[model samples]
Target: MTVDVRLITESEYPDWLRAVHTGFLQPPVASDEEARSRRPYTDLARTRGAFEDGRCVATFRSFAQQITVVGGAALPADAITNVTVTPTHRRRGLLSRMMAADLAAAKERGDALATLIAAEYPIYGRYGFGPAAGVAEWTVDVPRTGLDRRWSRPESGRIDLVDGANVRKLGPDLHDRFRAVQPGAVGRDERWWATRTGAEQLPDHPWTEPFYAVYRSPAGEIDGLLVYTADDKWGDAKQPLNTATVLSLIAVSPAAERALWHYLCSVDWITTVKTGRRGPDDLLPLLLPDPRAARITLQADFLWVRLLDVVRALEARTYEAAGTLVLDVRDADGLSAGRYRLDATPAGATCAPTTESPDVTLDVRELGALYLGDASAVRLAALDRITEETTGAVARTEALFRTAVRPWCPDVF
Candidate 1:
């Protein structure tokens, strides 16, 4: 049985769409209304499919994205999404065939790296991808965690609780500013903003009515946005405690962050406030009188990265410490396999192909893990995923790659 893999043409979009929905076990989007709802999430030209007997059996696509690396440089990234293979085509190597073509196309298009929210943890690692950054779930008790100077100093800004309709104007600009300061952050496209902020509705996933708040800075700049929903609940003692679940909280400045959290905690009848996601190095717990105030319920890798162009990806981001190290990077697909020397300084890193002896040896996956400045070289070496070919190489590599704020990707896509 032969499976043909290629980009779906404009005329074949309906079949391609159905194939993707089916692969994910979603009901066929049969009507005009349904199609319009789903259209924003897809780029028809970029969507790839695997056809067996003239029917698309697998689906894949990537959004045009720029991910912020260490030192505030945005690297061209292909944020892969809508990946699916129908159960009928399971274990047939359809995924591998499609992934290879997609990755090659992305690299040829000059995207330095590829990123995705892994539907399954173990699948992407073999494709030269590694778990780079993760999300943390915070459950905070509203009663104990007061907003009085715990999160930040007294703020001159005020949070105005707005509606979903108003978010259409404020969200995109605010998020662009927010992703800039954080390393490993991926930019959200217009489609993502519309669907996520409740400006547009999609099929299967019903938009839950949520409250939107805008944080205005002292100088009257809109810098932060928060979207959340509440469910009124009471304990056995009839306490009027409701639950406020934070869907998305984006703040461009420390003052804006404090104001958003302060507003949520100050909401009337809110018993517990929960967070959708935060970075592993989040200072939420420390902001309260009790360091153990926010209980992190879930801690798991949220973003997986694949270094498609090793030299390009390395040179795109800046390093903190100054050093020179040669790396022998092995790529299973041979796309980025080569020895590259990386010279680092406070300014930026310059990486190029070199014939020099490597001080460290590793696969593209481990390098992807280190690309964002989260995973340490010594840690990977201890796990045998990385090899230190020279004395003191691991420590030197660690010092060169350390980032002030651990990388965190806010958007799921």
Candidate 2:
């Protein structure tokens, strides 16, 4: 059977949505109104649908976002999302065709890089996408005896508890201010914030009302805030459990972070607390009287990144350790294939197409692997994807690319 690929029209969006939603186990299906609302920010004109027998059988959406690249200038990036294919349409090269077309369109539109949250890890790697960021989920069992006495004695900052609805309204402004200076962070628009806070109806896991606690500085500035809820019965009923969960925590400074955690843990009648997302270098443990009370588990959560333009993506981010290096890159798709030389100094990295000697040769996927903290140059060399000329070239390259903190994505697109 012949399959036709074309842009989806507004009238045919519902059919396209149905096809993609069917592919999701717990699809966050959007209403016609919600989909329409998002059209302004997304590249809807490029959203492709594959039709079999004149019926939409597969769909994918691509949109542009402004990402803050570390050590280099921020640039416009393309994000591939809502990629889905009906089960029956699988293995027919439908997705391959759609991706090639979409990526070509992205390059033509001048996107430096492309990112996506992959539903399946193996599929996108062949398409030149590499894991870029990660989010770690944590569960902490706060013991009654483990509560720190220092945290129990609250200090001078005035804490005001407000309604969650009001907090939702305030989230966008706060997040915008926070992301401005935070490296490797993306801006969350009002609509994204609404969806995150559950102010608007989503497909699955409806938002639960959250309590907002705003911490004011001595000068009366809203320096920090936390959105959380309490669960009286988090542990076994026979054992009696008191747990408070932190849905989101934002603080402008280190002191604010300490004060916020202290306030949350000091809540009356709550013996235990848990936060699903915390930074790898989070200071919570440092503030704890006994570090053993806080348990941390690290799991690999992947975020894939694809460099659309080799020179542009490399020049976009800043490099910490200064070095001169050459990379021989192979692309599955013909767009980004070549040897590139990257020279780094305290100023920044200068990347360009080169025909000179290559210190290390690798595929585009290997490059993507190194772009995020997920995979190191040494590992890629061990896998035979990277050929290092010097004994420590891989190690030196890894040190140059290492970020201060592991890149993380707290929000799921």
Best by lDDT: 1
Model 2 Cα lDDT, one tens digit per residue, 133-162: 765544555553365635643466677787
- What local distance difference test score does each model get? 0.83, 0.73
TM-score of 2: 0.88
Q: Ten consecutive residues with minimal summed lDDT in candidate 1? A: 146-155
- Model 1 segments more than 4 A misplaced: 28-32, 146-154
Instruction: Encode model 1's per-residue lDDT on 202-281: one tens digit a residue.
Output: 76577788888898987889988888899978889988779988888888887787777777777777868898888998
